[model samples]
Target: MDNNRLATKPHYQILDGLRGVAAIIVVFFHLAEPLASNHLDNIVNHGYLAVDFFFLLSGYVIGYAYDDRWHTFTVAGFLRRRFERLQPLVVLGMTLGAIGFYFTDSTIWPLIHTVPLWKLLVVLLIGYTVLPVPLSMDIRGWQEMHPLNSVAWSLFFEYIANILYAIGIRKLSTKALACFVVLAAAVLLHFAVTNANGDVTGGWTLNFEHMRVGITRTIFPFFAGLLLCRVTKPVYIKHAFLWCSLLVAVVLFMPRIGGATHLWANGLYESFCIIIVFPLIVYIGAGGVVHSKTESKICTFFGKLSYPLYITHYVLVYFYVAWISNHNGITLKQAWPYALLTLAGTIVLAYASLKLFDEPVRAWLRKKLK
Candidate 1:
């Protein structure tokens, strides 16, 4: 979610900066993913949780920006505003994926060379709308919602949450909202703890199980974030950005808990982080003030970079993963240089997308809609 949506509202500088931090870690997480045999041993073990953090942030920012505007804001208006903020980059990201798809052929994607140009175009067109394609239409081997740009799966779920919020969830009494959040949290906990892998991953596919995972991941965090914004009082916290950013990084960087024998242990840990630690971080981040010139500039830069970086970076990751898969037995040591390049390249691209496409396009849409 773009805090740019809060143009006239008070911005949570630290939350934006923290989002930037999480976005960057996600890049490294993907980079290191090819190195691991499974989620258990991935060097960036808990990095997938960043999606949950994003859901929470999205909810909080939506509530902060729109909760009081219900008198003037219709559901259509709210959804329009959200689509304006979110869809532009989604289009750009998927386009980038389509452009790179054939070029990134590797042993991992044996069918990449076989995919016809017309089918590629078809998938690209669907991806542009950020809607999930059925498995039968999967261009890539992975049964991803947006095979061209895998990250769009999360965006799809987010849109679902957004629609739900606009239609009815926004009208819930405060007590009712809290009860809903509680029930949602319980479902999330059960889903996480009972899973075979002990982590809340795998929502990319468009199946009943994956759909359940996607919905489960979305509801509690988004509404809990909404609840937080409505009820929490912000007390000034010194160095809140630094403290909160560090806290987020530490949780994401933590090694996987309880090896194969006790998958539920890792699941419990992830649930704890999502349900408890994430809200506390948001509370502190919301309460924070930029202390100095350097801090202010850092917050502004990071806040602007966060969403674009997240949405667009995965296109490059498709190539990076392809490169790694083509080269078998390539150690982390050997891959760091290329990984670093992908990181730097994606950051540069994300910044450019922010300045060139996202801001200009959003400004144009705002004027047109106004």
Candidate 2:
């Protein structure tokens, strides 16, 4: 057994830079959609697919970090680490949002009448691991929700992957095959059911149709990362060819292959994207492509602060929108300034928070836990 292979530290900085890029793309996607209507030309709106990138990255990093420890990893230790990594900022964000809601004229009435205290507590208890529906009907009123608990949908799957890993589920090759088969079958079943119901148009549903669909959609991508982690390849020739093939697969699927005939096609395409992209990133990181002194400093700083950036960027976006909306209506042409300002502000705030809040608290908790 190669102890060094098992003892790999996992590249942090490059992955963090990639994560920053993904977050920025998602924010751009959201901002672009509203601004698109103002533009006379059609534009590509695949920014939401950045979420898939994040999922792929999560799978790779989690597998790299925890796979070696799976046999002896305790649930308590695993959860404690997860909580230490995630909870502090989440609690802070939710509390700040609540306070902002309370102070702003945005109606404590809505928070009282629409958002039930019990439900909010349930959401917080879930530890931002579940994606709440964007809208829900309650007895008090019709509630429009934006997942104050956002960034969690992917975390839900991360937990799923972690649990599976802990149970040694990935150790059984046959079982892994069966699991993939089942996931594929479930995805096909969903598409068939939805097509039959003629619910092709995207909309909200009581059973959380979209979320269920999303889970199936992402399974293959997640597994692709897992498979990459467990396998080793010749970096020079074979790996490059494999990466190229996966990239080609993504390109083929980029065009919307219309109708029920292409239902599973989209998932397959996304899987290919993950298959190629994740390894390419890993290879680049491992091969010292990004380990230059200058690159290392930049990547390490951004990566260390990436999580805070993800959590706080939305607040920056909200203020950006407010500023743009107030100072003459924002047009597509006007989006560049707002986007740049918001991006810069997000980076600055994220860096400051990581330094002043996250790092110090994390250091203290590490000492206590030790």
Q: Quick one: best lDDT, which candidate? A: 1
**Model 1 C-alpha lDDT per residue in residues 1-370, reported as the tens digit of each score:** 3333444787888888888999999998999899998778889999999999999999999999899878765787788888889999999999899999988878888878888999999999998888899998888888888999888899999999999999999999999999999999999999999987788998899899899999999999999999999999988989999999999999999999998989999999999999999999999999999899999889889889999999999989988998999999999999999999999999999999999999999899887765
| Clashing residue pairs in candidate 2 (N, C-alpha, C atoms within 3 angstroms) | none
> Per-residue lDDT for 203-234 in model 2, tens only?
21224665554555455555555655666442
Work out the TM-score per prediction: 0.97, 0.70
Reference-based TM-score, model 2: 0.70
Worst 10 residues of 1 by lDDT: 1-10
Q: Judged by TM-score, which candidate is best? A: 1
TM-score of 1: 0.97
Residue 324 of model 2 has an lDDT of 55
Which ten residues in a row are the worst by lDDT in model 2? Answer: 197-206
Off by over 4 Å in 2: 1-12, 38-44, 102-146, 174-206, 234-272, 275-288, 322-329
Residue pairs of candidate 1 with colliding backbone atoms: none
Stretches of candidate 1 off by over 4 Å are: 1-7
